[model samples]
Target: MSAKTNKGGAQAPLLGSKIKLHIEKLAIGGAGVARHEGVVVFVPQAAPNEEVLVEVSLVKKNYMEATLLEVLKPSPARREPPCPVASVCGGCNWQHITEIEQRKQKEQLVLETLKKFNPTLQFEYLPLKESPRSFRYRNRIQPKFKNNHFGFFARNSHDIVEITDCLITEEALTTKFSEVKIWAQGKNSKDLQRLEMYISEEGSVRYGLITDEDDGIGFSQVNRFQNEDLVQTALTWAGEDDYPHVLDLYAGAGNFTFPFAHKFKNAEITGVELNPKLVEKAKSKIKEKRMKYFLSDVESYMRRAVIGPEDLVVLDPPRAGASEYIMRALAAARPKRIIYISCHPVSLARDLNWIFAWSQKLGTPMKLARVQAFEMFPQTDHVETIAELRVDS
Candidate 1:
């Protein structure tokens, strides 16, 4: 095939164009939404109710992407970022926006995405749950060591932005910065080295290099404080009603499965996971004989297994959301209740649309019961949400 991009790599018609616009609201993927000449524009590092001068960086057919050049009118929710390297670091995108505003943006984005998908759908929209510690809540971080510059990569670039401390990380992990630097220097390798630092289960600081063959531990919730609240919210939304069986899909290390097992002592909990490491960890904590975990992808597991009306389903899918096949299968199974926990609102909304559309086509419709957003990651646009759906009588 021909070269991937144009000669200068302009995706659409309007590259290197500058425009002034009023940001109406925050959109998914951590950007402020604006409209220019009937075309949607997305500006990063911007806040709602703000006027900004932006330069068009990437242009698509329907939407355009812009970089915030100057904030002509700053929003009341804007604040000074605590970290000195916040502007460059790729970790936190909404640090310039206030914590309260960060949550507001997340809630609005989640609601907007869901509404855009299904306008007629109705559900209870609860207030966004805020994290206990906005800063210093992150327990795990991947800091790069290269050419005597040790820190995170800059936004959209491989260049490293050196920093002494990351304010978002926990004190336990930040305190080991000195030791980490020493360990990197002792290696004396010129190439880039990826290192992961986190607080272990026993409350000890641990650091290790990431090799090509051995990637560090699988995906785990970084903010433990907010994670607890998320679990509680999921459990509460699940309600006290008893179901004979609970099926946890995309279960990561039994984060939701364990608590669900405890909450429903009479229910048989079955967790489906693809990662062997996470499956192994989740299996080691098996105290009850009623709980079972399978090492398989959710789509693959749903293919052979059958879900009945007496069972409840709990799904905590990754950012990509559940597959269309799985959603269709769940609709066909017609479970009693489904508690969906999502990290990305766009995918969650799309998945809901698929399930509802399939259920409608199959003549067994599902109704949305409850929904709430969780501000699990502070100083950023990422959000966790729990949605409850039940089969219509």
Candidate 2:
């Protein structure tokens, strides 16, 4: 074999070898993408546009993973992470990067993911929406309790990283950490008990255990500051067009459903959710006779419902995105407009691809009208995106 050739007659780098790489950009999981010997290397905690010295941690047939050892050159977007435990904790992955760069990366990633799925697609991509607050903005947080260790899980491990304060959490919630710690320590149960703390809509701070019988706040917007802008944007994009009904799928306590109902007073507002608790909550607030909340999965609801061409569908699904059946059904039904609020870009792109492909097959091609990324989550790789799809121009 030649000096640089492997047993398979292909060039491959030795594992545990130290190599210099120029980080071209950040990857989906908060890693820096660099190329070495025509193979991509993903280095954790590295910045884009920087030359970094990395140690090969793991090698694969096609790609390799590495650990950042030293920065030969730093990117302009690099910044000092404020969190003391950011490097060790799993709560955040992008805190070391600048806020401006974080949004830029998120925007680029969203578009890239979409393009990867729909190569020939073109849509009006809007400028990214920045979060109202970058730090101390999260109103809800879950701190673990095990042997009096009150904090989040460590990076790639179950071991709890003890923390008295979380930088992303609200000051009010952080102030209650001592009281919560004491409460957790007082518990006789030695097993780990997950705890929840959040500021309620009534302006009261509430804390409780996440029991098997009750899932504490299954889904919610951590950053309420940005949620206002998100809600307003969704409502505005939905527009004042009169439709027969406004259908909301995966509606958690009528977050967007109620707002859409409020705007379109003449249309029947129907919210479908699998979670019984959220459906109950949404039903309880039924002041309007036209508003209705159904306790069923989106797929199940769509199976029976006859979605008209004039109906407006607003779906805010989980990170997994809507199921394939739901997407295909929506494509066949061809609703007038679809406002999709997504948490994971890859899942969103996959779902969109399914819908568009199916619509094209059905001879009713729904076009992607607009898309915008929201910095709902700051100091982390997580991002929220809003996309609008319509049947006609």
Evaluated with lDDT, which candidate comes out highest? 2
Alpha-carbon RMSD, each predicted model: 4.1, 1.9
Task: Write down the lDDT of every candidate, Cα atoms only.
Answer: 0.89, 0.90
Q: Flag regions of model 2 displaced more than 4 Å.
A: 1-13
- Which portions of model 1 show Cα errors greater than 4 Å? 1-14
Report the lDDT tens digits of candidate 1 across residue range 322-356. Answer: 98999999999989999999999989999999999
Q: How do all models score by TM-score?
A: 0.94, 0.96
lDDT of 1 at 225: 97
Error of 1 at 23 (Å): 1.7
